[model samples]
Target: MEESTINSSILGTKEYWENLYQQEINNYLDHSDPGEIWFGKGLTMKMVKWIKSKSSQLLPDDGDQIKILDLGCGNGHLLYSLYQQGYTDLTGLDYADKSIKLVNQMASDLGIVNNLKTYVADVLTLYKSNLIPERIKFNLIIDKGTFDAICLNPDLDLNQVKSDYLATLEAILFKGRSFFMIASCNWTKDELINMFTKSSQSFLSLYDEIETPQFSFGGSKGNNVTCLIFQRLS
Candidate 1:
């Protein structure tokens, strides 16, 4: 494993995100915009569309609850977009209070407050502590930039996180045929796949992969982002 230069000592702590989300909420209020474009809206659209493409297996019915969960759902933009697509059972979880508050405000401003749910709870703790019961009942889970930040933690046990993630998904995905879509800028396509294949179980397996739109970097095409899709099989 190669070391990266991220403030794990800080980022791995709850205070880090609380402070960050506070600033983000301030920006949203002052500038009429949300902060941080993880992989950009284009990548988010690509993910949602790809899931929609697998409608027969991943979706319920049009305008019906699909029981969606958005992990580390900053500002609730992703949740808002899913609501626009008619996914009713949409929930957003974050460790920061401001993140949850902003998402709730966003939902209200968009007139979908009743359709979307937002909670302020540490997601990493979900593996052991069931702070939110709804955490284990999602049919579709979307993560953008959450794992990237998590993997940066220096004390991280790579395989343990994998096991915990799998456990949480298996517990919640009442809809057996569920999809977990993740977009990340820190990991390569191969690295993400290896994270699962190297620690395989029958519970969740890789379903597909999508390369985020690339850009010219160092005189060659480079994709700083990638989307990996996994399906709950047990």
Candidate 2:
């Protein structure tokens, strides 16, 4: 059976995010505006709270000890929140240079530049590239909407893209000791499970999940967003 696909959108394109972040940079410089939060501040905080609640289970020894990577970190809102919670080793990576610039600008303004590091790199091709050194591995990887954006790109082959993404995760995550948390509105809980776990080389397994508010219509209930956590199983 052919799997259903989400309609391709401009949101998937690098050019779109680059342009958006460029404008955000201008906005920040002129008006002191921070920029757009991908899912919203409330949801971002909710995610941080969830992590806080599970800190004992998630962190290696201390909150400052574990390295956290914000994949597709646009404007660094999520990392900023995590920083407030006392997670010191925070890195934000994005494909757009403007996105990195905006993150750096915000970090500088907040005087948290030393706590956060922003880099420009494509997540999809990251595993194949030497941009992020092999010696570096993250304890926690958070993806707010990066996978959704990757899936929405019209030009790419979905299967290959997903393979590359999972491969990248396998490469960067601290083997047998790391966790990956992702929040998505584009995929259902089951669909996401199938997508990540079905691959033959997949080393990730479902760990825990957080439920969002559900809406009812026509005697059916469904959530507008899905948040899930996965652990790397070696």
Candidate 3:
């Protein structure tokens, strides 16, 4: 499907996300056992490696910790992986209550509760409320499946919503140095690149686009996922 067409339905509102959670909550719960979360340890390691490869050049001279915000951080798998790799300043936001609960429980169970924070909030609505600190910036922001969900929403006003989202991202992202990494399956390379190019024209600059290997379990063979990295330039 065309990117614009996908965004027209999914990226337009919170109701879309809520309904998605309602439909998928059981599947998420069923799959989130101790060793059966969406991405296993191997994939999580690969994700961290991809994140680090994109973010290493942006690290501070003093080696001060970098702040990472993971959008739609289901079960905190990626965040947990980052913590294991020594990146502690991490925060995750998602709209699903079940996901939040599961992630928190997972963190507590694994004893990394002190290093992570998970919030139940829509990324589109995060800035409107106090879910995140005002004027806060992140060195890195990661999105895996969030945008795909947005595009799956059946009521999004594609152009306007995407424009607003891009602007909001610009406002919240660290100026001139932050990196945004998004992994998506529904969008092809050209479509993803075009969307980022258009979105970055106003707030960021294209830094890199890399193809990442994806793993699918069960009877499904995972398709290739694209990881698009953008750097704030304004």
Winning model by lDDT: 2
Q: Rank the candidates by lDDT, best first.
A: 2, 1, 3
Q: Which 10-residue span in candidate 3 carries the lowest summed lDDT?
A: 32-41
lDDT of each: 0.74, 0.89, 0.69
Between candidates 1 and 3, which one is better according to lDDT? 1
Candidate 1, residue 7: the lDDT equals: 40
25-98: candidate 2 lDDT, tens digit per residue: 99999998878888777789889998889877767654447789999999888998999999888999999999
For model 1, the stretches where C-alpha displacement exceeds 4 angstroms are 1-10, 60-64, 134-136, 200-202, 215-222
Query: For model 1, where is the 10-residue window of minimal lDDT?
Result: 1-10
Question: Candidate 2, residue 169: CA error in Å?
Answer: 0.4
Q: Clashing residue pairs, candidate 2? A: none
Candidate 1 lDDT, 1-234, residue by residue in tens: 552233455666567777888888888788878777667878878877876787677655444457888988888877777777777778898877877988877677779978887777766667567677653477788889887777666787755666676666666665566788888777776676666545555366789987667789679776778888888766
Please identify model 2 stretches exceeding 4 Å from their true place: 61-64
Displacement of residue 220 (Cα, Å) in model 1 is 8.9
